[model samples]
Target: MKKHIVNLWAFIHLVAHRFATDGVAQTAASLTYTTLLAIVPLITISLTIFSAFPAFQTVSTNLKIFLLENMLPESAGKVISVYMFQFSENAGKLTAIGTVILAITAFLLMQTIEHALNGIWHVRRARPWTQRLLIYWAVLTLGPVLIGGSLYVTSYFTSLTLGLGHEVHGATLYGLKFTPILLTVTAMSLLYLMVPNRYVMARHAWLGGLVAGVCFELMKTLFSNYVSHLPSYTMVYGAFAILPLFLLWIYLSWMVLLLGAVITAMLPQYAQGAMAGEQRVGYQFDLAVRTLVQLSHAHLRGEVLSLVQLVKLTHIHGEMLEQVLISLQDGHWVLRTNQGWALARHPDKILLRELFERLVFDAHHAQLDLGVIVRQPDLNLSDWVRSSAQLKLGEPCR
Candidate 1:
């Protein structure tokens, strides 16, 4: 239990570091701007899909109302919903070319979200354009249907239970209190699972989603209270106060979502407390050696490694591992393949001296005598990088 607690704390620290360094806030701000630009078009697309099916028309309206009320400050929700409805309604009258433009605008939002999530997952490749087109359109078309259907089913049952009059009112009240949280958790878990290019374990997604969802609820409550109690904003912007508050909520929403992605990506290492020591005493040399050792083994097995594979095996932070890979590439010892990364030269041909010089030797180490170190007979200055289990980068076949 004590170890688990320590691991949990370490994980939290690492998650915070990754979130801050990954420019999550900047991504959120950028997404906020894109969302503001794309909101009307996105709403228009959903409304258009609903228009095709008369039964879903009311589902569309209900979904919008539920989202605005549960996800935004009450004052901001009312004003912004009114404005969005008006804009979406106007969007319905666009010409054919205008409709294509609206769809592209929505695509831009999807692209931004995928890019941000992929960064969290350390994914270096994106889905092919054909695959992206299919996935993006499916999301644009079917996502609302799923959310609306779930909401409809729950509300239907609640309203049905109300046939007993006030007898079930308390149960219904409790249901109302919990529904938003459940929905938030489900939505977040799905986002974490599906947005990243790599595969995500269900448990990690659930854990991440649970934390982010709870935080979202807590933050929403506090933000709403602040906006309500503090009249300063209203006194200043007056009717326009809704704009800034709405934008602020959007930014906060993106942050929570992105933080969840970061947690999900790093959860495996966190599970073992592998990331507890964020910094190492000799990170550069140690990382370089470990990387070379791993690549050497994989080469003998006729396998190459993807970035995700390297992160999994090394238990090193993705960004740091990437930097080490870049250094090795510069030394012409590693190659990036279409399949992944591989050893550019046989491990037996590489020298430990090269690694030491590149990683350990520094301008600050001018006091160390190069000739004296080279003159040591037993040191075997030309030792193979993976020469032996002792040296570990390699040795001769014999």
Candidate 2:
């Protein structure tokens, strides 16, 4: 029953921590409402410009369909469609004004999009002004141009593939399917090159970005399929179902972004550490020894005690003890002796016992050591250490 309660409490705390860390969800909701307010004017400005270019007729329609189908909420789409019709009627006179308006609109849109994507990717760095300017510029101008180019490529490829649909067998279809894969790889490469604060190893960035992209694509498909399946929340919270859905999705998206960050940060270091480990055996033993010194009250002696006895008394492993003694010897804390181990400098025998006792007392489990330390939180291993050094120098140990 106690274990059950502890588990329940831990789960509650974990949930609280997650909500506390969720900057992305909070920022996304803020941007979503702001973008909603700007949606109609933004759509009208785009429609006006596209109407002037006959070559972009199909591109514009496809863009409109894509945005309406994928990006906007149902209510927001209706508003955009209404504004688009009105803009279509006045396209001739609106051209020059629309161009200026479009620039302003694109700036707003890119700012929001960049903020949203950065939030999604959990990018925490203060982006330099030069880089930020370049990113905004690319997203504002090159973004639409890229979308146009991608549509053109996809259309051409579809035409080619459809013509030879029957002639393309399993292997041929698989080979031709490289178009989307190539496009994905190219986009992933660009994101790695552009989005990071510092330089990322190309191989690590490629894999991490590909994973993010794949996860994003899967989420998009899953969201589209199940978005309407959110039951009438009357049974759960009635009219408030959308609130939970939105909040939950935002949380899920943030988790995905954090996962990408972890993958990118840890993978390369992990590979390097593994290779380094092969060349350095017994590193753990050395680390354990260092930790022992850090944990102890006074330097160990070589003549009075060997590492074997230290390990036996402390319940630390033999290898770990050897490492600790070797480190101490290297530091000139102890000297070789005919008798097992002894301090390099002769200290008062009684003083050595007291310091050794204190060290042993500290190395116990925390719960057991708490009683002695609680009354003297200011006192540390250093007090005993300095006392032992003083005894060696013939100073009184009071």
Candidate 3:
């Protein structure tokens, strides 16, 4: 029990630290603005898809109710739902070019979300625009249809069970009440798994999704209560209250979503760092040298070192390991492969002095600009750098 308590505290600390460092507030605010721009177009596109199916057409109102109820606080949900219904109705009057533009605008929202998720994972690479366009198009087109199908199936089952018997119907109703939570978790898991370029463990994705789903439900309940009791928005803005209230809710929703992402990205590091008793040691020359040597040995032996393997072997936090690996790749000292990292050149060609100069000394000098000012006449920086390299990389491999 004590150990579990310690682990929980450590997890919270790591998440708080990363949440601030990753600038989640800024990212969430940006997403909130983008979402507002795309919301109408996205809803129009989804409603269009729903209308294409005769079965879904009859129950579209129910679908809208479900979405609004689960997604927004009560009063805000009602306001947004009325506006969305009107907008979706008018969307059919648009020209071909306007429709195309509307679809692209909806895709922009997904693109922005992808960028934010990638930032959290420290992913520098991005899919090509052509690939992204196809992916995002499919999501925008098929996503609504799939959701409508699911809702249809659920409703069918509920009605069927009701006709059969009361006992079974009661159980079905109880299970259906949790549908919002299930859907939220499933969507969040997929987002975490697919948005970032890096591979996320399934367990981590599901755990993060579960946390986000629970928080979302709780927030909806709390916000609705607050809005109902507080009359502040209505008093201040009068008829215009819904607009600002909607914006505030969207901003808060994005903040919650990004917080879940932070938790997912940092979970591996927090778990391992706690066990290893790791702290912010920053970048040390010795640590870098050791990391390179390990990768070098694995490469020579035809062994692939995974991120988890490297973390365990080095007893280093995953984030720090990623940072070191990225720095090595940038300097052409290492190359990343599908399996893992490998040496860019033969170990023999990688001199200890040169490695240290590229990875450590250069980084330090860049930050401090030590070369910009004249040092004391007796001080010899080059000799000191070489000696430090030798001490860190004694008996160089190769």
Candidate that scores best on lDDT? 1
- How far residue 349's Cα lies from its native spot in candidate 1, in Å, is 3.1
- lDDT: the better of candidates 2 and 3: 3
Backbone clash pairs for candidate 1 read 385-393, 385-394, 386-393, 386-394, 387-394, 387-395
| Greater-lDDT candidate between 1 and 3 | 1
**Collision pairs in model 2:** 233-238, 234-238, 302-341, 302-342, 303-341, 303-342, 304-341
* Candidate 2 lDDT trough over 10 residues, lowest sum: 348-357
Per model, how many backbone clashes are there?
A: 6, 7, 0
- Residue runs of model 3 more than 4 Å from their true location after superposition: 52-55, 165-170, 274-321, 335-342, 351-398
lDDT of prediction 3: 0.78
lDDT of each candidate versus the true structure: 0.81, 0.51, 0.78
Per-residue alpha-carbon lDDT of candidate 3 for residues 332-355, written as tens digits (9 for 90 to 100): 888888777778887888776655
Residue pairs with colliding backbones in model 3 are none
lDDT of 2 by residue, 1-398 (tens): 99657654654454345434655456556655654444545555555445556765677766665555543334334455555556644543666776567556656755665555454334444366676778866644454555556655656665776887656557556654544444444455555545554344577667766765566556655764565464544478765555555545544544444444445544443444422442475554444444344324234422265444554454443333444556556655555454445555443332332333333343344423343353455778877465445344443223
- What digit string (tens of lDDT, one per residue) describes model 1 on residues 75-104? 788888888989999989989999999999
RMSD of 1: 6.9
What would the TM-score be for candidate 3 when compared with the true structure? Answer: 0.78
